[model samples]
Target chain A: MSVLLEARGVCRSFGGLDVTRDVNFKLVSGDRVALIGPNGAGKTTLVNLITGDIAPSRGQFWMGDDDITGLSIPERVRRGLVRTFQTTRLFANLTVADNVALAIMQRKRISRRIFSSATELPEVKAEWSEILAHLGLDHLAYRKVIELAYGQQRLIELAIGLALHPKVLLLDEPAAGVPHDEAPKILDAINRLPADIAVLMIEHDMDLVFKFARRVLVLAAGRLIFEGSPADVTADHEVRRAYLGSYADARHSA
Target chain B: MSDITMIHAPQKRVPFAQEAAGALTILALGAVGYFLYPDDLAFLTRLIGIAFLVLSLDLVTGYCGVATLGHAAQFGVGAYAAGIACIRGVTDPVALLGVGLVAGTIMGLISGALITRFRGLPQLVLSIAVGQLVAGLANKLSWLTGGSDGLSGIEPGKVFGVFGFDMYSRTGYLFSLAVLVITFVVLQRFVRSPFGLMCRGIKDDDLRAKMIGVSIYPRLVAMYGVAGAVAGIGGALTAISTGVVGLDSVSFERSAEVLVMLVLGGAGHLWGALAGTVIFMIFEHVVAAANPFHWMTMVGLLLILIVVFAPRGLIAPVMSLWTKMTRKGKAA
Candidate 1:
C-alpha cells in the first residue's frame, strides 16, 4: 500500500528529558492502525509533533510525497492531514451546524467571502448535514455546542475532523470521557468512515483497539516494543510484561 | 400550508426583516433628530459618526477576539488625512472620505503587523503604545500638525455638489447620517458572511480554527484593515462637522470612552454599538446639563448598574431574548 503519512526518526524533548525518542511509523491509504500505550508514553507528544503543534527536536514527517516537517498546523491541515484532541474542542458559541460548515469551508478552500450568507449556503449545508448524520448528531445541528453532552460533543469533534476530507486521521482517544452506552456510538461513527482514508487511533480501551484496528503498535517508555495483529500482540510475552499485563482477555470478550 | 412550509417560511423572512429593520432604524433616528432637536442636530450627527467607530471596534474585539484599546489611532489618522486633504485643495467631502479610507488602511496595516503578532494583554499594550506614539507625533509636529491646538480652517465643499454645509448644520448632519447608514449596511452584510462566521469561530477558539485549515493571521489583519476604514470614516465626519481636527481625536481617553460605549451596548453585535452610543451620549448630555458637578459620578454609577445587570451589553441579551420568544411561539 502507498503511504499517506510517515514519521521518520521523530524525537521530541522538553528541556533535558526526552518524550519521544527516535519513533518511526508509516500510515498508508486504507490502513487501520491503533497506537496503544500505557499513560505517559509520549502518545500526545508524538501527535503534537506530526500535527506541527510543537516542532520536533529531530525528525521528518511526510504527507504523501511532500515533506511536511516545516508546515504549520493550518498548513498541514490544508494537505488533508487532520486530527481530534483527547479533550473535545469546538467553537463553543456557535451552533453545531456552523462548526461543521466552517470545517467544510476549510476543506473546499473557498474564498471566505465577507458579503455572503455562508452559514446557510446550499452545498455547505448539505455537507454539514451529511457529517452530522454520519455521527448521529443531526438532531443537535442547530444547537450551540456548549449545551451538548460530553458524548455528543465527542461525536461532533469527529464530525468536524471528517468534514476536512482528511487523507489520514489521527484520533487521540476518541471514546475518552464518554459514557458507557455512548462508546458504541463513537465506535460505529468511526467505523462508517470511507476506506481510502487511513485512521490511526490512540485509545486506552483495549477492546476498541482489538475490535477496530487491523494492526497495533505498542509504545512503552517512548519506545516501540511491538508491531503486529491483535492475535500476535496477545501472544507476545514482552507486550504482556511491559504494557498489557492481564488486560489481554478484554480484547476477546468483545 | 403544510408544517414544513410554515417552518421554512419564517426562517427565510427573518434575514430580510432584520436587514430592513437596521435601515429603517437609522432613518427613524435621523427623522426624530431632525424634528426633536434641530439645535442639537450636529451633536446628534457626531454621535452617530462615533457610533461607526464603536461598531468598527466590535469587528475585531467582539468577533475576532483581538483585544485593543487604541482604536482612536485609526480615527485620528483619518481625521488628519481629511483635514490635510482639504488644506491641499481637495475640498469635496466625498473625496475627503476616500482620503480617510486610504489613511486608515495604511494605519491599520502598519499597526496590525505589530498588534497581530501577540494576543490578549500583550496585544492590548502594543495597541495602547501605538496610540500614544501617534498622538505624540501629532503633538510634536508643530508646523504641519499645529501641535496640541490641532489643524484649523478645514473647509469641506458642498456634498454631492448641491448640498452646501451652511452654518445652520443641515448639510453636515445629513452627510454624517448618510455615511453612518452606508457603512452600517456594508458592515452588517460583512459580519453575516461566511468569512464573518469563521472570524466568530476564531473568536470562540483560535486553536481549533487553526486545526480546521484557517490561515488566521492574514484573515485577522484583513479584518483589522477593514475596521480601520470604518473608524477612519468616523474621524473624517468629526473633522468635517467640527471644522477642526484636535489631538483629542486620537486620545487614549477617546479610545477608552468608545470602548465603554461598545461594551455598554454589547461589543459583538453591530446593533449593540449603535444602541450603546445613543444611550451613553443622551444620558451624559442630560446628566451634565442637570448636575455638572456630579455628572461623571452619575455616569459611573450608570455604567456600574449596566454592568451589574446586563453584562453582555444592553443589546445582545435583548436580541437573544427576542429569538427565544419567537422560537417558543413557534413551538407552541
Candidate 2:
C-alpha cells in the first residue's frame, strides 16, 4: 500500500520532558489503524503534531509526496488531513447544519460575497444536506450544537471531519466518554466509511479498537512499544503489561 | 390551490411587505421632519452626522468584536483632511468626502495593523494611544488645523448647484440625513452578506475562524479600511453641516460618547446605532433644555442601567419584549 501520510523521527518536548520521542509512523491509503496507549503516552501530542496544531520539535511529515511539517492546522485541513479533538470542539452557538455548512463553505472558491444568500445557492445547500444526512443528523439540522447530548456532539464532531472530505482522518479518542451502547454505533460508522479515506483512531477500549482497526500501534511513555495486527498486539506481553495487564487476561478467559 | 402552497405564499410575501411599509414610514417621517422642524434642522443634521460616526464604531465593535476607543481619531483625521482641503480651495462636497475617506482609510490601515496584533484590553489600550497621538498632532499643527481655535471659513459649495448650505438649518438637515440614509442602506447590505457572516464568525471565535482558513489580519485590515471610510464620510458631514472642524472631533470624550450610543441601542444591530443616536440626541436636547449637568447625569445613569440590565445592549431586550407581547396578545 502507498503511504498517504508518513512521519519520520517526530519529536516534541515540554520543558525538557519528551512527550513524543522520535515517533516514526506511516498511514497508507485504506488503512484503519488504532493507536493505543496509557494516559499521558503522548497520543494527543502526536495527533497535534500531525494535524499541525503544534510544530514538532524535530522531525519531518509528508502528505503524499508533499512535506507538510510547517503548515498551519487550517492549511493542513484544506489539503485533506483533518482531525477531531479529544473533546468535541464545535461552534456551539451555530446550528448543527450551520457547523457542517461552514466546513463546506470553506472548501468553496467563491469569495464569500456578504449580501448574497449562501443558503439559497444550490450546490452549497445540496452538499450541506448530503453531509447532514450522511451523519444521520438531518433531523437535528437546525438544533443548536450545545443542546445536543454528548454522544450526539461526538457524532457532530465526526460530521465536521467528514464534511471536510479528508483523505486521512485523525480521531483523538473517538470512544472516550461514549456510552457502551453508543460506542458500537460510532465504531460501526467508522468501519463503514469509504475505503479510500484512511482513519487513525486513538482508542482506549481494547474490544472496540481490536474490532475496528485492522492494525494497532501501542505507545508506552511516548515511544512505540508494539506495531502489528490487532491479534498480535493483543498477545504481546509488554503491551499487556503496559495497558491491558489483568484486563487482557480477563478478556482472554471470557 | 393546495393548502401547503396557499399557506406558504403569504410567508414569502410578508418580508417584502414589511420592508415596503418600513420604507414608506421612514420616507414619510423624513418629509414631515423636513417641513415641520425647520428650526431644529441644524441639530438634526448633527444627529445624522453623529449617527454615521457611531455606525463606524458598530462595524468594528459590534460586528467584528473589535473594541476600540480610538475611532474618534479617524473621525478627527477625516475632519482635518476635509478642513485642510477646503482651505486649499477644494470646497466641492463630493471631493471633500473623497478626501476624508482616503485620509480615514490610510489611518485605519496603519492603526489596524497595530490593533490586530493585540486583542481584548491590550487592543483597547493601543486604540487609545492612536487616538491620543492623532489628537496631539492636531494640537501641535496649529497653523494647519487652527489648533484650539479650530478650523474656520469652511464654505461648502451648493448641493448639486441647487441648494446652498447656509447658516439656515434646512439645507444642512437634508444633506446630512441623505448621507446618513445612503450610508445606512449600504452598511445594511454589507452586514447581511456572506462577508458579514465571516466577520461574525471571527467575532464569535477567532481561533475557529482561523481554523476555517480565514486570515484574521487581512480581513481585519479591510474591515478597518471600510470602517474608516464610513467614519471619514461622517467627519465630512460634520464639517459640512457645522461649517467648522475642531480638535474635539478626535477627543477621548467624543470616542466614549459614540461608544455609549452603540451600547445604548445595540452594538451588533445596524439600525440600533441610528436608534441609539436619535434617542441619545433627543434626550440630550430635552435634558439640556432643562439643565446641561442634569443631561450628563441622566445619560450616565442610562448607560449604567443599559450595561447592567441589557448586556447585549438595548436591542435584545426590546426584541424579546416585543416578541413576548405579541405572543401574549395572540394568546388573548
Candidate 3:
C-alpha cells in the first residue's frame, strides 16, 4: 500500500531542548496506529508538525505525493489531512448540528452558496443525520455544544472530523477526559470507521489502544523507541521500562 | 429517513413576524417624529447620519471582531471627498456617492493593512493613529478643507434632478432617512449571508477559522473595504445635510462616540447599531441641551452601567425582558 503521509527526519527544538528529534514516520492507507508516549514526549508536537501547525527546524513532511512542508494549516486540511486537538475545540455557542455542518460546508469543492444553506442540501442533511445517529448523538443535534457533556463533546468533535470525510484523520487523544463508560463508545466508533480512512491516534489508555490499533509506535524523550504489533510491543524490555511499566505487567498478570 | 418522522416545523415562522412588527414600529416612530417634531427635524437628520456611522463601526468591530477606533477617519475622508467634489461642480448625488465610496475604499484598504497586522491594544493604537493623521491632514490643508472654519460652499444637487434639496431641512432629513433604510436593508441581507457567518466564525476563533480553510488576512481586508464604503456614504450624507465638512468628522472622539453607540445598543445585531445611535443622539440632544458638560458625564455613566449590567448591550436585556413578559402573559 502506498503511504498516505510521510515525515522524514522531523526535528523541532524549543530553546536548547529537542522536542521532536529526527522522527521518521509513515501512515499507509487504511492503517490504524497509536502514538504512545510519556507526557512531554513530543506526541502532540509531532502531530502539530505533521498538520503544519508548527514548522520543524529541519525535516520534510508529505501528504500522499504532495510536499506539504510549507503549506498552511487550512491548505493542508484542503489537501485531505485533518487533525483534532487533545482538548475539544468546538464553537460552543453554535448548535451541535451547525458545528458538524460547518465542517461539511467548508469542504474545498463545496460552492459558497451551499455554505449559506448547507442544512437545506439533501446530501448534507443525510450526512449529518448519519454521523449523529452512528454516534448516538441524534437527540442532541439541536443542543448547543456548551450544553453537552464532556464525553458528548468528544463525540461531536469526532463527528465533526468524520463530516470532513478526510482521507487521513489525526486524533490527538480522542478518548482523553472522556468518562470510563463513554470511552468505549468513542473507541468503538473510531474502530468501525471505513478502511479507506487512515487513523493515527495518540492514546494514554493501553486497553483501548490494544483493542483498536493494528500497530503502535512508542516515543520517549522525543524519539521513537519502538514500533510493532501490540503483542511484540508489550513484551519489549525498553518499551516496558519507558511506557508500559506497571501497565504491561498488569496486563500480563491478567 | 422515515416520512412518518415529521419534523415539527412551525406553522408560521415566529422570528419573521417579530421582525415585521419591529419594522412597522420603526416606521410608525419615524412618521411620528417627522410630523410631531418638525422643528426638531435636524435632530432626526443627525440621527440618520450617526446610525449609518454606527452601522459601519458594527461591521468591523461587532461583526468581524476587528477592534477599530478610527472608522470616523474613513467617514471624514468620505465627507471631504464629497465636499471637494461638490465644491468643484460635481454636484450630482450619484456622482458624489461614487466618489465617496471609492475614496473611502482606498483609505480603508491602507488603514486595514496596518491595523490587521497587529492585534488587541496595538491594533487599537494603530487605528487611533490613522484617525489622528487624517484629522491633522484636514487641519493643515486650509486651502482644501478651510481649516477650523470648515468648507462652506457645499451645495448638493437635487435628488435625480426632480426634487430640490430645500433649506427647510425636511428634504435632507427625508433623503438621509431613505438612504439609511436602503443601506440597512442591504447590510442586513449581507450580514445574514454565508460570508457574514464566516466572518462571525473568524471572530469567534481565528485559529480554528484558519484551520478550516478561511484566509483571515484577505477576509479582514474585504470587510474593511465594505465598512469604509458604508462609512463613506454616511460622510457624504452628513456633507449634503450640514452643507459643510469639518475636521471633527475624522476626530478620535467621533470614532470613540460611535464605539460607545455600538456597545450601548448591541455589538453584533444589525438593528442594535441603529438603536444605539438613536439612544445616543436622544441622550445628547436632551442632556447636552440642559448643560454642555453634563452630556459627557451622562454618557459616561450610561456606558459604565451598560457595561456592568448588560455586557451584551442594551438589546439582550430588552430581549430577555420581552421574553419574560410574554411568558408571564401566556401563564396568565
Clashing pairs in 1: none
Deviation from native of the Cα of residue A125 in model 1, angstroms: 1.2
Model 1 stretches with alpha carbons more than 4 Å out: A244-254, B1-11, B14-16, B328-332
The residue-level lDDT of candidate 3 at B295 comes to 80
> How would you encode candidate 3's per-residue C-alpha lDDT over A1-254 as one tens digit per residue?
98989988999999989999899889999999999987667999998898888999999998877889999988888877888878988876556776676677777345244123334345666788899999999998766777789999999888878888888899999999999989989988898787887899999888988988899999987899899998798788897787655455557778
Candidate 2 clashing pairs, residues 3+ apart or interchain: A114-B193, A114-B194, A114-B195, A115-B193
Better of 1 and 3 by DockQ: 1
Off by over 4 Å in 2: A175-192, A244-254, B1-36, B321-332
Ten contiguous residues with the weakest lDDT in model 1 chain B: B1-10
Model 3, B232-273: lDDT tens per residue? 888888888788998789888899999999999988777678
Error of 1 at B99 (Å): 1.0
Candidate 1: tens digits of C-alpha lDDT, residues A148-233:
89999999999999999999899999999999999999999889888999999999999999889999998876777889997798
Winning model by DockQ: 1
Better of 1 and 2 by TM-score: 1
In candidate 2, how many Å is residue A170 off? 2.1
Candidate 3 ranges beyond 4 A from true positions: A108-130, A244-254, B1-25, B321-332
By lDDT, the best candidate is: 1
